[model samples]
Target: MNLVLFDLDNTLLAGDSDYEWGQFLIAKGAVDGPHYEAKNKAFYEDYKTGRLDIYAFLAFALHPLATHTRAQLDAWHAEYMETHVKPMITQTARDLVNKRLDDADLVAIITATNSFVTAPIAREFGIPYLIATDPEEIDGRFTGEVAGTPCFREGKVARLERFLEAHGTHLDRLGSSWFYSDSHNDLPLLEKVQHPIAVDPDTVLHAHALAKNWPVISLRGDQHA
Candidate 1:
């Protein structure tokens, strides 16, 4: 069976979920607005530039989860889904994913954002498989540290390999595979796939996609790249 993978942030959703989550917290007075905004923007810019320090970013990103009770976090996340996340979901993105599902392909979301920020977003997309950074939890409380390799850059490929291997298959075993992403950081898995599609790609990925003759598409636009 063919495998189809999507990058969660700008690829599948119009906005970055992780960054938005932080901003949502700041808006709710859960965090200091100026402080979190600056950090969030800086880290996000670092991410787009391919120089992100994943662990450092995570410690900041997951800190709020550790500070709040699970119940409070859940309540805020529900509001986050409605206020920040839901509007980012576009019709074209949904159609693309649903078509893949209807075609019986193996589909999943692979993201660098911690699962705490991305799990509900994945579920909302109706995609069953998700490979994201895991936040360490003990006794129902977050530790603000990663449980394993963060699914960023090369880590994404490693995690997907493990996931496929566990299913009794590997990347090469799939009849064909497709990875759709927006960031250059996804090049590891994007290059590995038989079909590497760039969706609303950033500068580096756009140039790379052009140089490699790969199809580039944008769900946000009326035209296909």
Candidate 2:
């Protein structure tokens, strides 16, 4: 059976959910205004160029979960989905995902963003499987620590392997595998797939895809292929 994997941020949504989530928190006063927004934007820039330090960024991004209760976080996230994320869910993304879901044996969204921030977004796309970075929990409260690998860069491959194992399958078992992503940070997993689609790629990933003869597509109205 064929396997299909999607990247959540720029690949599916018109904007970056991780960065927007931080801005959402800052606007709600859950995080420091100037300091948090500055670091958030810096981390986003680092991510675009594939120079992000996942550990440092997570420490900053996940801290709010530790300070707030689950209910409070959920309430805020609901608002986030409504106000910020919903508008970014473009028709192109929805159609692509729906088409893939109808064809693929296994469809999954594997993002570097933590599960707490991206789970609802996955649901919005009507995707059932998600492999995202896990935020640590202690006594039913967030610890602001990573559970395992950060699911960034090479960690995405590791996480995907674990997910396949859980389903009594492996990458080799699939007939054809596809991975769509926008960032160079996802190159590790992207290269592993039989079909590597660069969806609205950044500068580095776009050049790399062009050099490697990978199919370049854009769901944001600028179609390369």
* Top-scoring candidate (lDDT): 2
Per-residue C-alpha lDDT of model 2 across residues 1-225, encoded as one tens digit per residue: 789999999999888999999989989999889999999999998888778888999998889899999999999999999999988887888889999999998999999999999999999899999999999998999999999998898999999999999888899888999999999999999889899999999999999999999999989854321
Evaluate residue 18 in candidate 1 and report its C-alpha lDDT on the 0 to 100 scale: 93
- Global lDDT for candidate 2? 0.92
The candidate 2 region of ten consecutive residues with least summed lDDT is 216-225
RMSD of each: 2.4, 2.4
Clash count list over all predictions: 0, 0
The TM-score values for the models, in the order shown, are 0.96, 0.96
Question: What is the model-wide C-alpha lDDT for candidate 1?
Answer: 0.91
TM-score of 1: 0.96
lDDT per model, in order? 0.91, 0.92
